[model samples]
Target: MVLATPVYCKYYSKSVPYEPVRLQKTNLRFYLHDILSGPNPTAVPIVRPNQFGALVAIDDPLTEGPEITSKKIGNARGMYILASQGTDLTLVLYVDLGFTTGEFNGSSLSVLSRNPILENPREMAVVGGRGRFRQASGFITVKTQYLNTTTGDAVLEYNVEVVHP
Candidate 1:
């Protein structure tokens, strides 16, 4: 239900006033398995389809590779809004990604951005984080590696670089 909260919600985290004593940058490549058609789909449309203001809630698996059978290292959960009014497909995305089995085991990142979903490789902003990634800052580039129109399933490749403390 956190996704229901507005991006500009009244509740907020005051900015970190000081710089981290040491900053570390972590680069990772992963994939998101978006199953939007099966009986128990991970991503589902919550609003009128293909229309402006439409919303989609996502609880997709983040894997080590494009294959769904690959190692499941993390999870991506959030929502995106179809913000475009014309033919272009643009969305305002908000996601919280967390790793479960890798070096980033307990860390998580908060992301927010507006991107053209159809773009080959779209970038998003990393706003903050928790655990080892506290006070994080960076960007993530994503691409739709594979999509099954008939079943509404997709495999998305993600390249993330985060400077954190």
Candidate 2:
């Protein structure tokens, strides 16, 4: 019998708000388990390098309210997954939201993964609704592990952008 375990990887955005409110590009890199050595027959080697992506949007609506006339915002997220030489594993990613408008407040969004099952065994989520109004900025993230059930480590890379008008 073989038992599988879960691995955790976290990505954080720059603490500064995307100024100039224009389309921009960013990159995020995550380091996995340390390298191994020696002639080990049962040792699993690292195969994947890292993941990368871009954020795209077109005049997307981000905020709307009686006080504010029309504050349209557009944004998209992209991700890349690296290859691995392990058995079966699970990866988890998390996102942190910062500050925004009242309309988006108290509203939650879901984060989808290429490999749904490998994302999270419990659920696929991003931002939370509760306590959103009080928070100036929040966080959001996605997670996924190698395709092996072995107990090893790996790396994760994330790249995003915020386009504005």
Candidate 3:
């Protein structure tokens, strides 16, 4: 029998783009609740560690104006894994968020991030994507604007810097 071997190659330097497109949106919050039931159920926790799921309605300023309305141009939902890491008791989270509709109507955007959740300003990597955002890769910055403890409702702002062809 002939011996089989594996070969690997590595590159030290990579070319960088001069200018990358930046997308910014403010006053965006995800209303996570069951709509068919009428009025927020107020039974679920806004956030928790480990596996969790919710039906999200993306409230954007352009379409919904400033008021919180049921009209959603798109949907946002994700699964998460949260736990303590290292000696500092840092709350590390693994999040996979999927987006559809609006600018992402036909296609979808998938974001995967493994980072500390306790931080005021957090960043996540755009590992993969589909549709208009096909092969999209970049980083996103998240800022929590508001959080309602009782209803588990929150407002978050996002700044995305991405490279797509």
Enumerate clash totals for all models, in the order shown.
Answer: 0, 36, 0
The residue pairs in collision within model 1 are: none
Tens-place lDDT digits, model 3, residues 1-165 = 999899798878988878855643322334332222225432233554343332223322212222246455454444333344443323233333345446555654466665454566777677756666676678777665666655445455555666665
TM-score of each: 0.84, 0.21, 0.52
**lDDT string, candidate 1, 2-84, tens digits:** 55754655765787678548778999899989898868899999997647998989999999989989999989999989899
Candidate lDDT (C-alpha), each: 0.89, 0.29, 0.48
Worst 10 residues of 3 by lDDT: 58-67
Question: Which run of 10 residues does model 2 get worst, by summed lDDT?
Answer: 52-61
Candidate 2 Cα deviation (angstroms), residue 83:
21
Which of candidates 2 and 3 is the stronger one according to lDDT?
3
- Model 3 misplacement above 4 A: 1-67, 85-101, 149-152
Error of 1 at 61 (Å): 0.3
Task: Please name the candidate that would achieve the greatest lDDT relative to the true structure.
Answer: 1
lDDT of 3 at 146: 62
Give me the overall lDDT of model 3.
Answer: 0.48
What TM-score does model 3 achieve against the real structure?
A: 0.52
After best superposition, candidate 1 residue 23: deviation in angstroms?
0.8
